[model samples]
Structure formats: C-alpha cells, structure tokens
Target: MADSSSNSLFIKPIYIAFVIAFAFLISSPIGSYAFTAQNVIDSPLLTKKIGTNRTIKVDINGNGEFKSIQAAVDSVPEGNSQWMIIHVRKGIYREKVHIPSSKPYIFLRGNGKGRTSIVWSQSSSDNVESATFKVEAQHFIAFGISFKNEAPTGVAYTSQNQSVAAFVAADKAAFYHCGFYSTHNTLFDYKGRHYYDSCYIQGSIDFIFGRGKSVFHNCEMFVIDDKRLTIRGSITAQNRKSANENSGFVFIKGKVYGVGSTYLGRAKGAHSRVVFAKTYLSITVVPAGWTNWSYVGSTENLYHAEYDCRGPGSESKSRAPWAKQLTKEEVAPLMDVSFIDGTDWLPAWL
Candidate 1:
C-alpha cells in the first residue's frame, strides 16, 4: 500500500501539468495568420516565387507604375498568359478594382492584410456591381490584402440592399492571408474552382454564398448579427443545384465564431452542398446546425453536414435531421485539395 501511494503522488503533478497545457491551447484564439509554417498552403510570402520576374508596382503616392489598382491591371495585356506580379504598396485604396476575364495570370501582392486595403461603399440589387474588389479572370492570385465594402448594415434578407466585399466569378482563383469585411453577402463566390488559405471573412447573413466549387483552408469566419432581421442568420448559402454540377464549399481546419447565433449553413437549393470538416464551432453556431428556412425544396437532396468538428456548438444530438454524419471514407475526398484539382495547377498545397 505504501508503494502504490508513492507512485500515485509522482503521477499526479504530471497529470495536472498536462491538463493546464491543454486548457491553454483550447483557450488561445486564432491569430491573423491561423496556421503555422507547416500548415500554410502555397504562401507566396514564404515561397518568394511569383512565377515570373515581370513585376508592376501600384503606389498611391504616384511613385510607381500606376496610382490605382485597376490601372495596374489595365497595363497587363488582354491575352496575358505568363505570370506577372503587381505589387501594391502599403495604403488604403478607395476604389472599385476589377480584373476582366481577358486578363489572366496576374498575381496581386500586398505588403500585408493589415497594411494594404481596398475599400468601397456601394449597395445594389446586383451582387457583382456592389463589390469593392471584383475578380473575373482565371489563374488569379492575391496575398496579404484586405478587401472591404463599407456600406452600412442593410435590412437583412433583401437583395436590393446587398453589399459585397469581393466578387470571385472566375476559375482557378486563390487568396492567401487576406481579409474580407462587409455587413451582408460579404464574399460572392459566384462560380469557380477557388482556394482560400488563412483568410479572414466577416459578415452577417448569407455572407459566403454562390455556386463556387471552392476549398477554404485554415480560414477564420467571424459572424456579426444583423439587428434588422429577427430570424437567425447563416454563414453560408451554397447554391449547388445538382450533384452533377460539381459545385460546393468545403471548409477545412478553420474556426467560426462571433457575436449572435447562426446556422452553419442554410439550404439555398435542392442539392445545396456545404461541408465543415475539422473546424471549431463556438456557441455562435445554433444547435440546429443547418436550416432550410426560405428554401422550400426537398431537404432530402440537401448535403449540409459536418465531420470531425469540435467546440460547444458542434454537439450533434440536436442537429437537424437532414444534416449528415459522414464517415471517414465519405469525407476523405472533400477534405483533400484534390477535390478542387489543386495539385495540377496550383504552385503548392498540403
């Protein structure tokens, strides 16, 4: 009995120390750059390779090739095939920037998300027209920049009052270490095969919407309640009309939290697909997990689901009946970069 008591005393301190360390880890909030060096995907800042040496500078102080971001993009030829770097200097550019479909392979680089920002204020019935920064070109890449639409909080659930921070409507587009800020419909990921790495997206309702087949890796989603609407808001409203369309939003290893309760996603189509895998959900996420509120279509076709998610809001006992509990084999493809065919064209990925 004396020997057993001595062994217990020796192990107690070690167990207590491990518990304290684990508590610290769970309490720590994700920083501006969520992932460590190993987890980052194709980070240009770390890779130091922008595909080509053809560099253009955009400085607001009239010191570079152009004063506006649009001007620098305009300088690129319509049939641009090779990678060209447009280094935007540290400043808040207050204008609407567009990358037309004709101009491709343009890499928009910034000092950092905190230092470089593109801001505009416009609310319209059209989501694309109200965007502060719109990208319509394929093979586009942006890093360390902030895109924002400063339109005041509009009445929720209204199309005419939609404010979009960024509109991505082209294929093979990627953003890294960037920030998107708006009140409603923040990121219109309309149609594309896109990748977002370590980005911060903030909005209230239907913030990340559209039919884009995209992968969000280590991205942080901050939700703000729309006081105008009595009903709870949703983080995503994916519009995958059919399973054959190959359109969905897959979020991996990110954190979603903020003020007011909201669903992980709401059904926007009969086959609307949205998956959250290995993500952290705070109390901000409602117990229902997903909703089909305005969508009167059959919930049987909806693919709203969660896999390996944690936190207070991830409890599945009260999850919606339609919400799927996927097995490892079922979720393997969605959790991989191959889901978007990133290994073929992307410079690097996990």
Candidate 2:
C-alpha cells in the first residue's frame, strides 16, 4: 500500500459513484422500459408447442405442404378438435384468409410480423366484406403475424365504405405479437373473450371496435389523422349496450401514440364500457380523453375509466367530466387476467 489515506479517498469516490448510480437506476424511467422489455422477451405464447404437434406448413414458394394459406386451411378436417399449427413462411401473402366457426383449436403461426403478412385491398359498405383476415372459430390462437388491409384511404365522413383488417367474432381467441394495419376501422373486434399480447394496432377511425370482453396486454395503438374528418378519430368504439352484458374492452400496460390527435374511446352505446390501466398515453391523445357523440343516452352507465396511467396525455384536469380516474379497488377486478378467464384457457406455459 503506497499510502493508506490515498487508497481511502480513491475507494470513497468509487463507492459514492456506485451508490448514486444505483439510486438513479431505481428512480429513473429506465426501470419502466426494462419491465416492458422483459414482457416482450419472456412472452409465454412464443413457445413452439401450442397444444399438439400436428403442423401444416404454408409457403409462398413450392416447398411446403400447401402453396396458399387457404389451401392448407381447407386440408384440415371440418370439425378440428385437436390443436393444429398452420405455420406460414416468411413472405407477404396477398390474399384474404378466414377461419370458419366450425374449425376450432387451430393455431396460426408465422415467422414474424415483420416478415410475414396477409394483405388485401378491399373497401365495402359491409364491415365483414372489407376484412382481410377473419376468425369466427372459437379456441383459436395466432402468433407473429400481420393482417393488413391495403385499401386506399377513403374520404373520412363522405364514404359509406369501411376497410377492416381483421374481424374477430368468436370466443376464447388469443393473439400474440401480431399487427393490424388499416386506414379506418382497422380491427373490428366483433365479439369475444379475447387476449392480445405484445400486439400493434394502427388505424385512423374506430380502430378497435365492437363488444368484446377482451384484455389487451402490452399492446400498442397507433393513430393517424383522417384529414377529411371534421371530428377527431377514436381508438375504440366499444358497444356494450347494457350493464348486464358482461362485455368491455380493458387495455392493460399498453401505450398509445402517433401523428394525429385521438380519444381513448367513444361511447357508442348507453353502457359502453372501456378501461385503460397502467397505460402510457402520449400527447397524441386529446385532452377530452373520451367522447360521446351520437350516443344520446344518459352517461350514468358508461364505464369509461383510466387507472394509474402516466404521460402528458394522461393528465385528468381537462378530461371529459364523464370520464373517470378509477380507484385501485375499482380497477382490481379488471386488471387480473381472470377478467377474460385467460388463465384457464391460455397456454399451459403461460
């Protein structure tokens, strides 16, 4: 030891630096980002095995069991009770795909959202007709795929035609690491008890709609302005018409951000229920937070609420008077995975 005092001074500075760093690590936004990254990295739905090992491969090239996705789906027996995996290869499938109600327990797996896509260009007065991907089958699961409606963005309020990317109309459906992209009416979440994990949904108007008792976990909503619309677009249009419906859309630990302004949700029915819990709302969200245009009924039963949310847009001062900042007790039942009975039907590894 050259000098005991000199050694003491050197160690002291290093110790103090480490202590400061630890404090910063615990207090900074890095902690939140780390938690989000952990969810993405440790998703239980990414497992190779969904339920059974029966797999059908669909490749754009002539290498797999089928050349087209629909062809592979047709190959599956009519009333499929066993879990079968339809693995789509890394390519853009420019076609419409639908899973009928008769075929249940099917898992549609793709290489990745960035690599695999189902693309269609259609716009019609009928919501079901414009959809690119439709799932009317119960007990269905999908992973790492993108469903996109490439229809030309139409004039906002002038056109009767609507473009829907995906129509999920059956119960017990789950999606992991998926994407839905469209200009308007992107995800017509018609009706179901659904769970979405680490998914991205982008749209302009009424992006996520319908009366689904669903839980969106770690999902992202990207809103773009419909320049033609005189009114701002809304992220959701949940149409729970009555208190006894047991239907609502609950978004947990997600983020909403994008170019133009939008509301968290709109009251499409007398009892339109929606909750945003522990979510990050960016400045893209309007200060009104929620809207009730065209809904002429009393607001007493509307369950539009936010809980423990953060970010500039989460500020409550200017939010609509009808919108609620729920107490912890009020939000407890909605936060758990049991809200959609996910634990019972979700993957065993999850």
List model 2 lDDT by residue over 144-210, tens digit each: 8999998877765444458999999989998888999998899998998999888999988889999
lDDT of candidate 2 at residue 79, scale 0 to 100: 95
List candidate 2 segments past 4 Å from native. Answer: 1-28, 41-49, 156-160, 348-350
lDDT of 1 by residue, 181-289 (tens): 9988999999989999889999998999999999999899999988787767899999999879999999999899999889999999889999999999999999999
Tell me each candidate's TM-score. Answer: 0.88, 0.89
> Which portions of model 1 miss their true places by more than 4 Å?
1-50, 157-160
Top-TM-score candidate index: 2
What CA root-mean-square deviation does each model show from the true structure? 7.0, 4.1
The weakest ten consecutive residues by lDDT in model 1 span 29-38
Q: What lDDT does each candidate get?
A: 0.89, 0.88
